[model samples]
Target: MDLHARLKTYLQNNPEAVGKVVDYNAGTDRLFPLDLTAANTELTTAIIADTQAFSNWVSDKLRANNCRYGIGGYMEHRTIYAVSSHFDTEDEPRRLHLGIDIWSDAGTPVYAPLAGKVHSFQDNNNQGDYGPAIILQHDLNGLALYSLYGHLSRQSLDGLSVGMSVHKNQQIATLGNNQENGQWPPHLHFQLMFDMEGNYGDYPGVCKYSEKEKYRKNIPDPGLLLGF
Candidate 1:
């Protein structure tokens, strides 16, 4: 079977093995679907460029919907990356987001959905970068899998080390503020990868539109494990 097929089958077979990536309660909290694409006319360029304004916009959306979390952006073609040159390239700009972003308040806790060992971690502190990020290595039977948590608080990396074992539902990190989380609104960039391609600490969360098919093979929708 292919990677996507295997992942979907594994998740479907072992629902109890996966845990929440955030402090979400199905009974009390609602998840508001957020749109950061060009279709979202309300997100003006000015608000996209201004960190505080963008944060306030996210908060307003969640509050208006009476939800605790704003979630979306898996394989989403986002225009918000125009706010930073970090995503620009001579060939093409990276506009396709390869992860699911959980928009929430800074300092909100992030948890591991499965037991794994820290594969790599570092603070990618560039503008529009991932900020404090982590990649965990997991095994589904014999299949090698990886999970990345990005836009995390610097404190999240405080005692972490390579190959450190983490348990399911363990509090691994917290969401960071705009001042630290790549100058954007606070959110957790959760992604799953079949391979790291020798990358350590950080990987491209956004890919060039032209290379979407190439990345699609390596990166799959995180919702497979998130159970959204």
Candidate 2:
């Protein structure tokens, strides 16, 4: 199925996350939009430049202006689901994206949207992968589920263990910079998964467009909660 169809099915099955939520056009109104500027070489160069200077200047600039930096691209930017480099292989195949990303400055605090237990934690520690990451297992309506928070600082996972309890709105992780993070501009890769497939410490946040059906079954749109 296509992204639209898959997303609709997931929401219909998982109403508690999507039901009666505040409305926010999250993909729109972001500080930056990931477009051809991001797809082209010139902008890639500029991004490298910005990444180089990000720690010393960018963070302060966003905070000083009191701007709530966004985590994903704007709706006008035409963000599409493609297999990320993290899982691409000529010997094998590619995997596509399962979640929407919001591009924001680093060091921003990531909050737990609801109370849950720390299901697992890991330092994925590879280029184009989640750096320091954590997943929380939530019991909603007697249904077991999980939320994955990616691109976090190493400090975020310190003292955190599998099965640890986390409170709602609790500060779990501080967003990391590019050096410690997965070498992209700072952003959170938040994903919701119904079945972990017995996986621990890592899960495919991206899947192949061709295999969208299989992945969409396991991963659901995070906006069902955050879009509120």
Candidate 3:
């Protein structure tokens, strides 16, 4: 079987082996499905330009809906990329998000969904970047897979080393604030990869719209493990 099919089958066969990435109670806490695309008429260019305003808008929406977390953005073509030139390229802009963003408080704890070892990690502190990112390597039976956690607190990298063993459901890091989290709203960018493409410490969480097919094979929907 191919990597994508193998991953889905593995997760489907061992649901209990996977753990939560963030704290959430289906019986109490609610989740707001956020939309950052142009279809979201409420998100204006002004709000997108101002980090604080953009954060406020997200919080306000969650509050209005009585939700504790705002979630979505797998393969979402967002217009919000206009806020940064970091996503721009010579031919096409990279507005296609390959990860699922979990919007919550800055200090929110993040946990590993499965047993893995730290493949690589670093603080990619470029503006509109991942800030602090970590990539973990795992083996599904004999198939190698990877998971990436981006926009994390810098403290998350403290004392961390390559090849460090991480237990399933272990607290790996916490969400970062705007000051250190690439100047965006506090959120965890979680993604799964079958291949890193020789990338270490960082990988492209957003790709050019035209390259969607190429990425689709390497990066699969995180919800497979997130269980959304």
TM-scores, all models, native as reference? 0.98, 0.71, 0.98
Candidate 1 — which residues are off by over 4 angstroms?
A: none
Predictions in order: lDDT: 0.93, 0.64, 0.93
Task: Give the clashing pairs for model 1.
Answer: none
Better of 1 and 2 by lDDT: 1
lDDT of 1: 0.93
Residue-by-residue lDDT tens digits, candidate 1, 18-79: 89898877888899999889999999999998889999999999999999999999889999
Q: How does candidate 2 score on lDDT?
A: 0.64
Clashes within 3 Å, all models in order: 0, 9, 0
As for model 2, its CA RMSD to the true structure in angstroms is: 6.0
> Model 3, 172: alpha-carbon shift in Å?
0.3
Candidate 3 Cα lDDT to native: 0.93
lDDT of 2 by residue, 1-228 (tens): 644455556556765544311123446533433332235343333434455553334445446654455434212222122223566656644435666565565777787766789999899998768888888898765556688888888888889978888776678887887877776567777887877898887787765456777776677667666753
